[model samples]
Every structure is written in C-alpha cells, then in structure tokens.
Target: MLYNLFNKVSSMNKFAALTKHFAAAVFWGCMMAVPGWAQSPGGTEKELIRLQNEWATARIKGDVAFLENLYAKEFRITAMNGSVVERDADIAVFASREMKPELITDEDMKVSLYGEVAVVTGRENLKGTYKGIPGEFALRFTNVFVRRDGHWQLVTHHSTEMRKK
Candidate 1:
C-alpha cells in the first residue's frame, strides 16, 4: 500500500510539471503570433525615440523623401507663428534650398506612449538659413505619432518659439 501511494504522488508531481510546461508553451506561442503581445512598454518607448532621432537626421540632411516615408498621408504641422502646413506643403518647404537646416537638434524630450499612439514634447534648436537669411531659433515642439501597418508614422506636429526669460 505504501508503494502504491508513493507511485500516485509521483504521478501527480509529473502531471503538475507537464501542466506548467504546457502553459508556458502556450503563452510563448501566442506572443509569437501577435506582434503587439510581444512588445513591452520600454521597447515601444525606445522605438519611438529612435524614430524621432531619424526624423531629426532626415531634416538635417534635407532628405524630404525619407521624411515622407515616416509621415502619414494626412500629416500636418503648425508653425511657431500658428500657420498650418499640410503634407505636400511641408515636403515642399523641406525640399526648398532656402530652408536649409544646418543644425537640427532635439533636446529635453519627454515621450509618452498610450497603446498605439505616442506624444513627444521637446525643444528643437535650429540653426539654418531661411530664404538666404542666417538665423537661429529655439522652439518647443510637440510631435504626435501613431502606429499603423506595424510601423509608427508622424501624424501631427506643432511648435512654438521659446521666448527669452
């Protein structure tokens, strides 16, 4: 009788181990099938920051084509003067020789992610030529990004000049 009881307990222990292994396998399988399920909040934030840096680099290089790929179809921007620029116009401005951005830097950025949407707020310090006029400006900017088709796209942007204290 003692041998039989020991055998039963050993069987139960084996079953429990099997159940645990099965549960872990199922969880990992689901994560593999669903792209969103596998991503962590920290990973999302890092990807968003990387995209922002890519955008800044594109601006410095005057690579509007690269920016176009990163922007959404209905992308828009509000200038420091409160003027709204649509997708085509924004690309045009960037493509223009007069809008040369010698230096484009993002500083003190705060990035927040909510599911598929992200908001980034930061200071953009620009040293460039505007219509043959060399000037420098520091602006506080907010850029909104949304995840679509497994990629993040910039949908909206707004900037306001940073005034002297």
Candidate 2:
C-alpha cells in the first residue's frame, strides 16, 4: 500500500510540473505575440513633465480647455488629504476658482519610465489666491503619463502636502 501511494504521488507531481511548464510557455508566447509601441523615454519624460507644468500654469490662468487637452479621457486625481477627483471635476476645480495669477515652482523632480508609462514625482511650492482668498500649499505631487497613439496623456495624478515640523 505504501509503495502504491508513493507511485501515485510521484505521478501527480510529474503532471503538475508538466502543467506548470505548459502554462509558462503559453504566457511567454502570448507576450511575444503582443506588439510593442515606440516609447522614447528621454523625450517622453521631458514632454510629460512639461505638460504637467503647463497644466499648473493653465490652472493659475483658469483655462479649462487647456487643462482638458492635457488630461486623459479617464484621468483620476487624488489629493494628499485622501480626496479623489475625476477628469471633469478636476477641470472644474480650475474653472470655478478665481485665479490671481500665481505660480508653482518645482523644487525637486524625478522622472522614471517603464515601457509606455512614465511617472514624474516632484516637490512643488505653490503660491496663489483663489476667489480673492489667499492660499499657499507645499505639495509633493506625482503625475503618471501614458504614451498612446504617439501622444502622451496624463492618466493619474496625486498630491500630498507635508506637515510643518
């Protein structure tokens, strides 16, 4: 009975190993079948950050159309305070706010790329007035961009404000 049980277990192990290898080959084959899009990491990273900077400038200028063009159709923004805003709502925030011509200066910026996706992370000092109300926030912002159809669009964004020590 012991010998029979060991033989059965060994057969099952062989079957499992065979299945694992088969699945791995299928996955690799599918990956190879997928076409690769031409993504330039150097220029793309620069363009994406430039686009985000332009978005902030437009926000200060209260230009919704510019913001609209800068963002992807399905943009998701999350504030440091855990507040979430979608594409429309994000553009609306700039439209509704009365801008007093301010500026966002990025202190430190880092850009990284993976395939067709690029992420830009930076610390920015923002100074502005909204609706005649004085406002200032030091934000660490992350902007994610994707290259699609030979165009880079802002896909996801997040901002977190640090507490004063």
Candidate 3:
C-alpha cells in the first residue's frame, strides 16, 4: 500500500538521521580526547621535575632506601669521573661512612617527554666529600626515566664535570 510504503520510508529517514547524530557525537568525543592526550605530557613533565628534586634530596640526606625505590632495577650512572656506577655501588656510596653530601643543588633543569619516557638535563652543583677527598664540582647531567607500573624510575644517568671558565 502507498501508506505503508510512506511509513516505512519515514522510519528509514529517521534511522539515518539518528545514525548521523551518533556518528557526530563519536567524532567530537574523539576530537576532545586528542587535546586531553596532548595535555597529559605537561603533567608528566612536572612530575619528572618533582622526582628529580626528590632524588637530589635523597642523595643529600644519604637516603639509600629512597633512591633504591626510585631507581630502576637495572639503573646505572656514568659519573663525571668516567666511573660506571651501578645501583648497588651507588647505594654503597650513600651508605658510606666517609662520603657525605654537604650541599646538593640542581639548576636549569629541563625535562622532555617522549610517550612514557622522559629525558632530564640539568646543572648540578655539589659540595661534598668522598674518602676525605673534597668533592666540589659543577656538572651537567642527563637522566633518563621510564614510566612503569604508574611510577617513574630512573634508568640511566650520565654526567660530565664542567670545567671552570
């Protein structure tokens, strides 16, 4: 019948309009997600900075346990003296009786985020003593951190002592 055909055609048109609206909603939702994803890196950068400071504080206080928790299991640091410092070695330094940090400060710290990895570069001015040898140095350092299990841990560190100008 003509009336039946008209009703069926109207229903089809209604279904098409609903589909269009649903598609539009999904499209806009995805568009909003992009910006949210982009903004997430900003939070990560701030967190990395905070972690950097905390690491420095732990070093100054000789908090070996804290450093152990923050560092990855395979963490390694190439020191300014060209010594490859592994996790256990560094923890030993923190636990040493002769080496004690008097002042540990960082400056000009910058962090770059690559997905779940963050690279931090900064200047560290340290005043300390190791084995009765004065440890006063200005160094530029790079620290690589990775996010795992919703926590950031330092994976690698390399530092070069900056010569006096």
Candidate 4:
C-alpha cells in the first residue's frame, strides 16, 4: 500500500513539470511575436523621420531627382502665402534656382503614426533666398506621410509663416 501511494505522487509531480514546461514554451513563443508586431510601427516611425531628414538634405543640395523620389503622387502643398502647388509643379518650385545654396531644417517636430498614414508637424526654418525674394522664413509646417507598397511617402505639406508683430 505504501509503495502504491509513492508511485502515484511521483507520477503526479512529473505531470505537473511537463505542464509547466509547455506553458513556458507557449509564453516565449508569444513574446517573440510581440516584437514583430511592435517593430512594424516603430520601424515605420523611424523610417518616416529618416525620409524627412533625407529630403531636407536634398533640398539643401538642390538635388531635384533625389527630391522627386521623396514626394508622393498627387502631392499637395500650401505655401506660407497660401498658394497651392501640385506634384510636379511643387518639384519645379524647389528645383528652380530660386533658392540659393541653403539649408532647410526641421525642429520641434511632433510625429504621429496611424497605420498607413503619418503626420509630421513642426517648425521649418529656411536659410536661403529664391530669385532675390527671401525664400527662407520661420514657418509652421505640417507634412503628411502615407505608406504605400511597404514604404512611407510624403503626400501633403502646408506652411504658415510665424510673423512677429
């Protein structure tokens, strides 16, 4: 009778251990999946910022071709003066010799990611001129990004001057 009781208890212990091991395996499998999900959003955010930085550099370099790839189809832009520009026209504006060899930098940017869409809002400080006209200004700008075919592209931009009285 004592031997029978000992055997039952030992078997129960082994069963419990096996159950614990299976649970642990499942937990880790789930943990690994979380990263792939989280990475998509985080990676998109970082990529959005990187793309903006590259476009900014292209602007500074006056590289129209590089800048062309950065823009999206049907891209819409509103200038600080409230003028609307379409895709190719906007590219023309930038590629035109209006801007001197200058730099465009983004600051105080707040970026939001919504699935396939991202919005970047911030201050754009320009240090350049366009054909004797002051091309640079302290402006508030918002750039919209959309993810297409596994890539984020800039789709819309609006800038408003922050004038001091």
Candidate 5:
C-alpha cells in the first residue's frame, strides 16, 4: 500500500509539472501571435531616425529614386495646406522643379513602434519655394512607416503648419 501511494504521488507531481509546462507554452504562443508583443531587437529606433533624416535630405535634393523606394505605392500625404497628395503625384512634384526645398530640418522627433508598424512625429523647419514663390515655415509632421519585405517604407504622412505665437 505504501509503494502504491508513493507511485500515485509521483504521478501527480509529474502531471503537475506537465501542466505547468503546457501552460507556459500556450502563453508564449499567444504572445507571439499578438502584434508587438515580442520584444524587438535594438537599433530599430536609430534606423528609423536615420530614415527620417534621409527623407529630409532626399526631398531637398529631389532624389526621385530614393523617394520611390522609400514611399509605398499606397502612400499618401496630407500637406500643410490641407491638400491630400498621393504617392505618384508627390514623387512627380519632387522630380520636377516646381517643389523646391532649399532646406528641411527635423527637430524634436519621437518614434513609436508596433511590431511591423512605426509612427514618427516631429517638427520640420522648411525654407524653400514652390512655383517660384518663396516660403518659409515650420511644420508639425507625423510619418507612418510599415515594414514590408524586410524594409521600412513610408505609408502615410501628414503635416500641419505651425503658427507663430
């Protein structure tokens, strides 16, 4: 009878261990399935910051090729003037001389990440001309990027002109 009780107790302990492991496995599986639950590797934020800087440089230089690769096909921008510009149209304007950007500097940038998506918000100090009309302004901008095919691309951008106090 003692031997039988010992075997039964051992079996119960084994069962409890198995149950614990199974619960852990399930928890991990659920975590992996949920978006942004998994811990991201380091340097993602720095890479995104670099991308933001590159975007400003690309705009000033009218680097169409870089812009093409950076912007997703469905990308859209809500301009400071409240006009919505699609990817192709924006790229065209950048390629042409109509949208001249003498300088664009980003400041006080913040980046938020969610698994495959990231949002960047900052102020852009811009000095340039559009259609020979000189303009200088500060804009508060939000740029959304999505990781696609292992590369980040701008999916949406919205900017509002910052009015002087």
Candidate 6:
C-alpha cells in the first residue's frame, strides 16, 4: 500500500511540474505575440528616426504615394499657424503642388517610446514656397507615431514657427 501511495504522489509531482512549464510557455508565447514587445529600444529608435528621414525625403520629392502609406488614416497635423489639417487635405496640398518644399531637414530630434507609441520632438528648417510666396522658416515640431499591425505610422504632427532672436 505504501509503495502504491508513493507512486501516486510521484505522478502528481510530475504532472504539476509539466503544468508549470506549460503555463510559462503560454505566458511567453503571448508576450511574443504582442506587437513591439520583442523590439529592443535601440532598434525601435533607429527605425523611427529612419522613418522621420523618409518623411522629409518624401516631402521634398513630393512622393504622394509614400506619404499616403506613411500617415495613418486618422492622421492630422497642426501647422505652424495653428491650423489643423487632416491627412487627406494635407496630402492634397502635396498632390496639387500647392506647397512646394525645397528643403526639409530635421535637427536635434529626440524620440520617446511608450510601448506601442512614440513621440519625436525636434527642430525643422524648411525652405519652401506656399501659394507662390517663397519662405524660409525654423520650426519646432512634435510628431506622434503609433505601431499597428507590426508597423509604425505617423498619427499626429504639430509644429510652431520659431521666432528669430
């Protein structure tokens, strides 16, 4: 009888050990499935910065297709003049050649990551023309990006024209 009891207890212990390992495996599997959970901070930051550079290049080259793919459907921008423009409207300006951007450069860009969201703050120097009026401006800008479906998309952009001191 004692031998049988010992065997039963040993089986139970083996079952418990297997259960513990299974639970751990399931937990880690879920974590891996979460978007951006496995990305290192350094890698993510570099990717975001690259995206920002791509955005500038797209603007300069007037690549409407790239702009359309980079910005989310709900994307919005608050211009230096405090006017808010939706994604379609903003794209329209580029599509229609209403806003000609000669140069768009980002400087002092700092990126902050929050799980699936990132915020980039920086200074932008722009040499461009709007409505046939040539202009040069220095601006401080904030760009918000969100990770969705394992990719990042720009969601919001706000910029203020810097005053010359």
User: How well does each candidate superpose onto the true structure, as a TM-score?
Assistant: 0.77, 0.69, 0.78, 0.72, 0.79, 0.79
- The segments of candidate 6 whose C-alpha lies over 4 angstroms from its true place after superposition are 1-38
The collision pairs in model 1 are: none
In candidate 4, how many Å is residue 132 off? Answer: 2.7
The predicted structure with the larger lDDT, 3 or 5, is: 5
Ranking of all candidate structures by their lDDT, best first? 6, 5, 3, 1, 2, 4
lDDT of each: 0.86, 0.80, 0.87, 0.79, 0.91, 0.92
User: Which pairs clash inside model 3?
Assistant: none
What is the Å distance of residue 103 in model 6 from its true position? 0.6
How well does candidate 5 score on lDDT at residue 11?
74
Count of steric clashes across candidates, in order: 0, 0, 0, 1, 0, 0
**Local accuracy of candidate 1 as per-residue lDDT tens digits, 1-165:** 966865777777978977999999999998887666226877787788888888988877879888889999999999999999998887887788658888888888888887678999999898988888998999999999998888989999999999988
lDDT of 5 by residue, 1-165 (tens): 966765777777979977999999999998788646225434788789999999999999999999999999999999988899999999999899789999999999998988889999999999999999999999999999999887899999999999999
1 versus 3: better lDDT goes to: 3
- Compared with the true structure, model 5 gives a TM-score of 0.79
Measured with C-alpha atoms, the lDDT of residue 54 in candidate 2 is 81
> What's the true lDDT of residue 14 in model 1?
71
Which wins on TM-score, candidate 2 or candidate 3? Answer: 3
Error of 4 at 93 (Å): 2.3
Tens digits of per-residue lDDT, candidate 6, 12-101, equal 797997799999999999878865543578888889999999999898888999999999999999999989999999999988888999
Is 1 or 2 the stronger prediction by lDDT? 1
Highest lDDT: give the candidate number.
6
Candidate 3 lDDT tens digits, 33-144: 7644345777877888899889888888888889889999999999888989899888888878467888888899999888678899999998988987987999999999
Name every residue pair that clashes in candidate 5: none
How much is 56 displaced in model 3, in angstroms? Answer: 1.0
Residue-level lDDT tens digits of model 4 in 92-143: 7677866664768888877887756889888878888777766557889899
